[model samples]
Target: MKGIILTSHGTYASGLYQTVKMIAGDFPNIKIVEFHEGDNLENFDQKLIEAYNDLTYKDIVVITDLAGGTPFNRSVMSLADKGNVAFLSGANFAMVYQALSSEIEDLSEFVADVLEKGKSSITKFDMEEDDEESLEDGI
Candidate 1:
């Protein structure tokens, strides 16, 4: 079976991680690691490496918080010529869910589809506030 690594900006908040875990529930063997905690890039990198080494099987996917940031960049560093690993930043629970539950056996196809889905999932939501709309109501 494939393994999953859910990493964020830093070490994940326990509550948020649990929520993601709850939503991602059902994978027989998926692992998660958070990378950013109080700007501790060193710890994040180490934990990410450890998680990668431990959970990797025939296929492994790493979900990062952002594409060019320390978490993603450092995780990419672990790839020194290794190709069995797949990395995804700009991640969300939906993408991880898809990766965890995919039915395809071919790693390439699975990774391809998952990456497409992940990239497609990012959207331009309107964060700019309107004078009339409340933040709660997306005004």
Candidate 2:
């Protein structure tokens, strides 16, 4: 089985996990490491280590809130040389949901698919314009 770790600078990690649970119910092999205001590198390191150690899966995927932020950096350094670990930064709800629900055995392919899903999920909505246009079209 593959595991997932959601890390973020604030409560985003926990919040994202809660949202996922609300939609998909509880799932094992999924964990969250939240970095609070007073947390430093060592704190993040410890949290990551604990989360990694608690997982029963051989292959693990870590999703961070920002690409170059502390959480992402710490995860990268902590998982370095760990062949079974993969990192995916700039995480979102779609990515988390897809990852938890995914049955893909190939770690690389699973990460790629999740990244694509995350990228495609981001959209710019102009609701007023869209509604006006639709009304004008008599649809």
Candidate 3:
């Protein structure tokens, strides 16, 4: 089995999780750890450890908001020894949605697809660059 762990500097993790739940409903395999203001690194690390321990999946993926931020750094340092776990930073709705919705078996393939879809979802809609005559035309 595979699972997802979402951690961020503040409520971003929980907020994003809630948004995903609204669209995709609840998924039992997903866990969220939030690092709020005034929270110490030790506490946050402990909470992350608990979250990881709670998951029964053999393979886990930890997603964080920023690459060099506390959440990401802590996860890497703490879980680096875990062979079946992977880490991804700068997570967005598209990445999480693809992760929770997909039924893929291979962890590498799953992560690759999530990265591809997530990156592709980011687009700039410039009227001038896109050669759109008017905003109303796009609508």
Candidate 4:
């Protein structure tokens, strides 16, 4: 089956790690991992490669915090030589939760679904806003 890994700049506190969990809660199929030190642009690739190997998925999606950062750039580059994984940078709770909730398919389709859900889940207005005002608030 497919799986997900959420990578962030490692924290000494597990409290920080617990903050970004997949919305569906923890399951074997979807898990999160962290890389603490030596996670900067200079050595992200090596660190990511190590983490990737430790994961249990054949088909995997890695979600990182920011694009152009060490983690994101390294993940993208690693994907160029590998054929079984999808790497998405600039990850948020929305994206990670979306990925964790679904079943596996083609990696490309999976990536698109993640992006779509992440984009759609963002409501410009508050959930408690008046319905009448929301309609004219410009979609």
Candidate 5:
């Protein structure tokens, strides 16, 4: 089984974890680390190391909220040397949800698919003229 580690500044990691749990129930191979305000950098990095060490899965993916932030940079420095680990930034519900819930045979393919689907999930919507008119007419 593959493991997933989510880290973000503030409560974003915990918030995303809760959202994932609400949607997909609890998962055994997923962990989250939140870099709260006033948190020491060394301590946060230690927490990340603990999280990484705790997961005994064959493969792991560390997902962060931002690319160049502390969480991402620290995670890379800490876990990049470990083999079979992937890193992703700008995390969203769609990607994390899929990554935690999926059971694909190929980790690379799974990550690629999840990334693609997550990107595709970003969409724009514009109400049509008829719908606007109906709303205006109280239909």
Candidate 6:
């Protein structure tokens, strides 16, 4: 089994978790850590430790809202020596979904797949008018 940890500033982690749950139902070994206003690095460390300890999976994937932010930096430091852990920044629903649902045994491969999926999922939606205009122009 694998696990997922979502960490972010403010409520992004929690909100993203809820959205994932709404779409995919409750999953095992999934956790969220929110870094609220006035929260210190120690606070984030504690929360992350708690979440990491609670997971039953050997391979854990941690997703953060921003790269080089407090949550992301602390997570990187905390899991630095942990070979079973992988870190991903700029988390979104698609990445979370893929992480939770994937049954891939290889941690590196799984992380790579999720990263590719996450990146590919992001796109600009064109309005109908613009789409039609582009189609008419043979785009």
lDDT of 3 by residue, 45-104 (tens): 888888889999878999999999989999988887888888998899999888877788
Candidate 2 to truth, TM: 0.87
RMSD of 5: 4.4
Clashing pairs in 3: none
Judged by lDDT relative to the true structure, which candidate is superior, 4 or 6?
6
CA-lDDT, candidates in order = 0.68, 0.87, 0.87, 0.64, 0.86, 0.87
| TM-score for each model | 0.68, 0.87, 0.87, 0.68, 0.87, 0.88
Please list the residue runs of candidate 2 whose C-alpha ends up more than 4 Å from where it truly belongs after superposition. Answer: 128-139
lDDT of 4 by residue, 1-139 (tens): 4676566656411232354442245556654545566545545566556666766776888787776755566677765476778777766656666777777567788889898887777767665765776577652
Candidate 2 overall lDDT versus native: 0.87
**Please, what are the lDDT tens digits per residue for candidate 5 over residues 1-111?**
579999998999889889888867888988889888799989988988899999988889898999999999999988899877889998999998888877875878978
Between candidates 1 and 6, the TM-score winner: 6
For residues 1-139, write the lDDT of model 2, one tens digit per residue: 5799999988998998898888778889888998888887787898898898898887999999998898888999988667899999988989998888889999889999999999999987688656656656631
In angstroms, how far off is 100's CA in candidate 5? 0.3
Per-residue error for 86 in candidate 4, Å, reads: 1.6
Clash pairs, candidate 5, are none
Q: Cα deviation in Å at residue 37, candidate 5?
A: 2.1
lDDT of 1 by residue, 9-100 (tens): 64552344465567665565466665544766677667767776777477787777788876678778865346778877767655666777
State candidate 1's TM-score.
Answer: 0.68
